[model samples]
Target: MDSKIKISITNFITVIYLFCFLIISNGTYISTAAKIFFSILVFFSMIINYKKVFNAFSLWLVIYTLFVLSSVSWALYGEFARQSASTVVYTTICSLAIPLLLINNKKDLEFFYKIIIVLPLIYYIYYLIFYDVPNIFDLRQDASNQIYNNIGLYAAYSFLFVMIYQAEREKRNIYYDVFFVIDLFLIIISQSRKSFIYIGIIVILSMILESKNVLKTLLRILLVFVLLFIAYQVVKNGLFGDSMKELLLSFEGDASDSSYVGRMNQFDISIGLFNQNRFLGLGIGAIEYVCRFVHGQSAPIVDNDYLDILSDLGIIGMVIYYGFHIYLLIQYIYNKKKWNKKNLLFFVLLIMLFIQGFLIRGYFNNYYIPILLYLIYYDTKTLKQDDSTILET
Candidate 1:
């Protein structure tokens, strides 16, 4: 095969892997599909492009190893352990695949970005127009699927990337701008306050750190605040429907509400679990086990990431996970000294993501973290700006 053809094939695989990850049914089968495709692509790319592995191994290979080990050791339930191991390996492959198999040059980055930039926004729009109730885009308070929030996260990330591309090229694509508006509108409508807050932080930090155009940044900030105010008014006032209005206002509306009290009560119970197993934790999968045992249920419905980690992996997992963030911070700080503007903006965006991971429950979930890990690895290794370099397949 021609070298360019081979590279294009690999790039296509990378894009497919991402698409499958983000757009598939969020079905049990979807993850199996991702796992299979990622495994094949990563192995094929590794064998073909053996050299990049050594070059980029310093960035992510070790982290992958540690995560695998920890997940294996911590997962107490047999099934959960197996699933956790599967998830960790899948993510590791995806994290390494981009830099190793595809994205060897600027064109590769653009190619990858072009695909990524739109799908997430489209997914959000689909929900906004179709699945969502008339005029309401937010997920309900009881929403627990990792996929929904991951779409929002993906949208936020894509918007930030679009902004960077716009700033860098001194141009604006109306499509990206439209996606941004739709994404924000959907976020508010979905009533996912965490997504909005995380995006807000990233935007503010990026504006402060990267954009030289202060007036533009200020205008953007003003616009966001105004939109947020409008969303709050609309949601709080129940403009969409009584159920959604009640849902949005539920967080602050009633102390006696069962959902509100239940989460608070669960947190209190988790606090006791944490106190008992402060360091080693209850063992991997222990929370689910305990929940099942206590509630006579098959799975623990724990939504808080902090409590989940503490209960399942104990303090050991917490330390290593947070340590990973510290390492990422060091990488960003080091890069800032050398300072590529796009990279700096990415670092700013990631910092918010890391913070949000702790503050929100979705961070530890397999869907979004792997993508974030892939970006970090890619940023760490990609240096040259050439657009035509063929990737290895």
Candidate 2:
């Protein structure tokens, strides 16, 4: 294939993948079909790149996905379970396959970075014009509810890659600067507390890893916190009015927060259910079926990712899932000398992902996990060359 053609093809498929992940979800028939189609293409691509992309991490993911699918056999709500299981499988493939097989060079990676940041804003515009969502621009109370939580998290994820992209290059670009501001605004309006906290921690850690001067880094960190403090006071004072305060104050981890309550409620329900199925789980989708179909709540019922894995996949399943994580950690520590900003940040992401998993679900479908997995098997010798060349290209 011609170089441009290959790039275009990959870009097309990737945009479809991102569209499914960020804009629409499996809940809708059209999006469900799109996800399935994207997953099929990813599956074929993974097979084609089997020699290069296939590894223990990828294999572990395949196994975990298969295990989830297998649970459909014993699921109480078998049809719903299969549909739910298929969604997980499809998303897992879409997320993992991108980093593993599609992202082949600096250009592809950069293209992906742009897609992650831009697509959701496009969707938000579409939604704004069409839907009855609150005026997020007006910054009214409950503005964040204008979009689904996961949809808003798309902005958070986009900002994540933006930071990573900037971290990779020594010379910062105004290109990323624009998106940096946009992403922060989107995150703020999303009212996702975990998104704010997660990005803060990750950004600081990446700066620490990539920093050459401790004093400079410390000053920068202090500056960040100072700005945050100012922002806090502004919101607390209702400088924009009580409604604006309500909109932004969702940043705090109030015990009575609905998202927190959803997590705890799901955790409690998961524990109660897990006690019954101590080994293999009640079968994939069983929990979602009970919660959404039976009880009419948000599907998956378990809002916590770790608990989601434990509750749906069970003890045996968690082992298969975390085993890949453990392998990556061991490799990162064992090859400390080879560590650089990219891989080191990936390691940090993995750890923070675990922490984030406690608060949010869907780590299985996060594109970053497979990228981290790819880094684990990535050649150390090439890391130096790739690091330099990425900037040049």
lDDT of each: 0.61, 0.64
Stretches of candidate 1 above 4 Å error?
A: 1-7, 55-79, 124-150, 210-253, 256-262, 296-301, 335-340, 359-365, 380-393
Residue clash pairs of candidate 2: none
Candidate 2 on 1-393: residue-level lDDT in tens?
A: 113434487788777666665566447886778767766777677677666446575677778888888888876577877877776677677666665556777677767666766765776676677566765664334553435344446666666666666766778776666776776676665555566667766766666556557797787788778867886797679663454355455546445445445655666777776777778877776666667766676645575766766667788888888787777667666665566555666666766766766765554455545554554444333444443333110
Residue-wise C-alpha lDDT for candidate 1, range 1-393, written one tens digit per residue: 112433477567766667666666544686677777777877887788777777433244455346545656644465766665555556566667666666677667766666666767666655555453333344654454544665667667777776656644545556556767866665555555456667767766765565457787677678767877886797678675355455565676665445445566666667777777687665555565566676554235466677877876677777665565566667766545455656666677668756765555543435556456556656644433332322211
User: Candidate 1 at 124: error in angstroms?
Assistant: 4.4
Looking at model 1, the pairs that clash are 74-284, 75-284, 76-284, 107-387, 137-189, 137-190, 138-189, 138-190, 139-190, 281-314
Error of 2 at 131 (Å): 2.4
**What is the TM-score of each predicted model, taking all chains together?**
0.74, 0.77
Residues forming the 10-long window of minimal summed lDDT in candidate 1: 384-393
Model 2 scores a TM of 0.77
Which candidate leads the pack in lDDT? 2
